[model samples]
Target: MTPSESAAAASNDTRTRRSRLLDRVVGSLWPSMALHRATRLMAGGQAIRAFGLFARAARAGSAEAEYQVGRCYLNGAGVPVSRADGFRWIERAAARGHAEAEWILAALYVDGVAPCCDRQDSSGSPLDLFSFDVAPEPDFAAAEKWARRAAEHGSADGQALLGYVLTFGPKSMRDLEEAQHWYKLSAEAGCPQGAYGYGSSLVQSGDSEGDEVRAADYIRLAAQAGLSPAIYLLGMLTERGWGIERDQSAAVQLYRRAAVIGNRSAQTSWGRALMWGVGVEPDRIEGESWLRRAALAGDADAAALIGDIYAEAGALPPNYAEAAIWYRRAAEAGHAAAARTLGLLYLSGTGVGRDPREAMNWLGIAAEAGDRSAQVDLASLLLNDGASHPGDLAKARDWLERAAASGNLLAASHLGVCLLEGIGMDREERLALQWLHQAAREVVSAQYWYGRALSEGRGIEADPSLGRAWVARAAAAGMADAEAALAEMMVNGRGGPKDHGAALDLFERAAAKGHVGAMYALGMMRDGGFDVASDHAAALRWFEAAAERGHEAAQHIVGHSPQQNVRDDR
Candidate 1:
């Protein structure tokens, strides 16, 4: 070797020896170091040395050191994993009142992380180290005991976990009231899960201490802490203006945020907003995809919403088949609206084959489930002659009565008609008239009936003038019966001075709608020269047309009085 090469070799050997001496010094000092410094060493990649330090400190009765060593063993960090060693160290820290350690020990017991077993010799002889020869199962009683200790030690997370276990643990251990008490304490201590649990319970109880404001405040705190469920609930409250100012835009943003975190309910809300263009641009495909995601996640409302979207003829070309598919899905999930809609589809054969029996079955299900629309439809079906069992007027009346009592206007009208005709129940003229009057406020048929009754003094005082006005309103609303009735009233001047021209116009209008009575009246007017110049040919043609439609009066006049000028005025 030359002189420079020899000096370089000596320099490298000196540096190597110095590095080994520094490592030995550091490794030797680790066992005596404080927990924080040891943790920093572990963080700085001296895992082997830090593990030794934690073990030594734990043996010296340091609770934090024991907990760190236990956690490391549980996670197989810088040491071969040992469940028995982890439990022992964790229990030691817990015995020393280490809050997190108690919580971890409770979790270990609850999750059966390390089942206790006898340490037997290789000769299969039972060891005296522990009592049991077999592995011990999970002990929730032990978990609860340790969890209470942790909670009493002022661990917010421990209190929250204890609250959860008390509320949703095994049935034998559940205690909702106590759970709420713990949750309140944990939430006051600033635990996010505790805040969420307490807030959710309050919201579900309809009113918290008879005020929504307190519930909303807690929920807002949890939401601010980035809790997904709390965010979703706040969005709902914002959208509905419940304990908050209604803001569709803000609700949409919240729902979007929660949806990004995989909240199924928020996904459904976002999808519905997108589909309906409520605070969002309409995106049919994307909205439908999200809806499908929620439905697949078991949201019955999402399935029903999908059905409604497909059923709306204005929004999309009606796809009744697809609508039925989704409606059935929701129906199976006990959605009353979906069942009612499916029943209607069956009745009209819009999507499925027309099956009265199936329609009645579904309608019955919805009606019994308290769907007012379904009750009315089921009553109508029963009143008609097409039901599986020949029309059961008695049952139909009962259903109608139930629906009417529930404020169903159409059901009231049907009940009135039934009472008037004595078709189902015993006749009750006064009750029938009352129902007719109420129904006449909106329904054209009810208006016509009420007007006719008033004009004829049936079950009410005669009010021909008001009756004629009501009939006129119905006629303007395109009721053929009202038109024919008004035409006769005009011809007789029962309500006011009659105009023959107006009578003729009303007769023509009613006749054009295939009103048989209007046709007969028109023939009588033409033959008598009351409205126009007597045209026997036109009168005969009117008579023949009415007779062809099975009008008995028209048939009689056409056969017996072909050329006779017959005019009857009463």
Candidate 2:
């Protein structure tokens, strides 16, 4: 043989080996290639051809082809649906280590769409994504078994899913500690859902030993990975300065980003921020629209916000009826403020019909939850209506004392009145005066009682001059009783100097407010010419007006007076 012939023979042998290697590799990939072609054909509407190709490839033991064939049979895609055939094919592919096929078969078994497989397929148990709920009976026990198997096989999605199933599954099946282990593994493997799950777990652990810091770190990773819930949670933490610096503007932006991706919590929060100008310019109508979207998605907070918008009379055209409806919905969903508002509305007969029992029921819930305003209102109602029942007054007093201790001035004043009047308990005059004195500095009504007590020496040393000054202060604040008391004192020179002219002006002012005593005093002044020129007709008119209003003294005088046509000895 020649040298040239030898070199050509060697090249041909090498080329033949390379060609055979390429053929072997291509043969191994042909099933996947055929499945892809079939998918394209089916998508292009050539269903019959696609079905034939898929069946052929499936018969050749192609796992991808088998999965496609199973899905087609199950859903009746260009063929009569045959669940049994679909199940058989999917199970076969799953046995051959097809991840998607395994997931489908597991879902079928767990959901009871297909019979449960006890120790079945060799390629790990059935593990499914919850997003695909093609059917509905859930067997968490079977799901747990299958998901654990998938996790053992090093599937990131399977590990994450296993963690979630175990974390939130039936109490009997839940193992939070084990679930956290799987979540950490899946998160390290770069699964966004896993990171989110791990973050949530750490956040809920309530262990302050670096857990919050860890949670924030994982949550940030998940949010960057585009997980909606993680984004929303991160926004909340940012807004509240929980394990992060408070950045309300940044939180609003995060909420908007998550909202755009259809996160319900983010939608509600963003709407609230916009409505309240919390970190953005107020846009009530736009905020309302977003809140409506969240409410439709079953967000209780959004519903509560809508209720507030309707209930605020000065902020919007008051829609008490609509407010009641939203408040009821939110209250039923366990919103504390909504429950309190609903109770107030019921008590006031603003939106719903007056129903004191229902009002008390709602208020009771809010009071138990530590709402200060609810405590005050509940106490007032109980004191007014519970006076006839033994021990009920004590309960009312307890509530008043609680509210007063919480720095409520109105509650303090009311408590003083209850002590002084002995509405439901024995009167304690000294204690009443102490409370009255405390409230008198801030409350107009309290001033009257405190001043009267001082003047009459009811519970304290008599200080008529100081008492008159206090009464004058209350009268200036528009208390009709204080005005009448001060006027009489001035007329009689009881506390200070006699000033009938000043007394008559005070009497006229009180009379203008329909104070019966002031009207009778004005009649006497006119009849006697004490402060002004006597006018018989004017005196008769004032006395008659006072008498008509059930003034006994005025009535007695009117009854003894002569008729208009008769003469009277002056």
The candidate maximizing TM-score is 1
What TM-score would every model get versus the actual structure? Answer: 0.64, 0.63
User: Which residue pairs in model 2 clash with each other?
Assistant: 106-126
Per-candidate clash tally: 0, 1
Instruction: Assess candidate 2 and give its lDDT.
Output: 0.82
Candidate 1 backbone collisions, by pair:
none
lDDT of each: 0.82, 0.82
| Candidate 2 lDDT trough over 10 residues, lowest sum | 127-136
Q: Write the per-residue lDDT of candidate 2 for residues 1-570, one digit (tens) a residue.
A: 699999999999999788556434543567666667678879999776677778867877898889888998899987888877788888788778876676667666655666434533468765432223455577777667666766887877778878888887789888899999999998999989899999888888748847877888888999999999999999998998776778999999999999999998899999999988889999988999999898778787999889888878764579999989988887887777888899999998998999989998898787777777787777777876774466656767888888876777778888887788876667888988888888888888888878887888777788888788888888999888889898988987877888888888888889999999999998999998586788888888899999999999999988888763365553
Q: How far is candidate 1 from the true structure (C-alpha RMSD, Å)?
A: 10.2
Model 2 regions more than 4 Å off? 1-215, 260-264, 276-278, 296-300, 313-317, 351-358, 387-392, 485-570
Report the lDDT tens digits of candidate 1 across residue range 87-168. 8899889999999999888877777655545666789985543334566566778888888888999888788778877876
Q: Residue 382 in candidate 2 has what lDDT?
A: 80
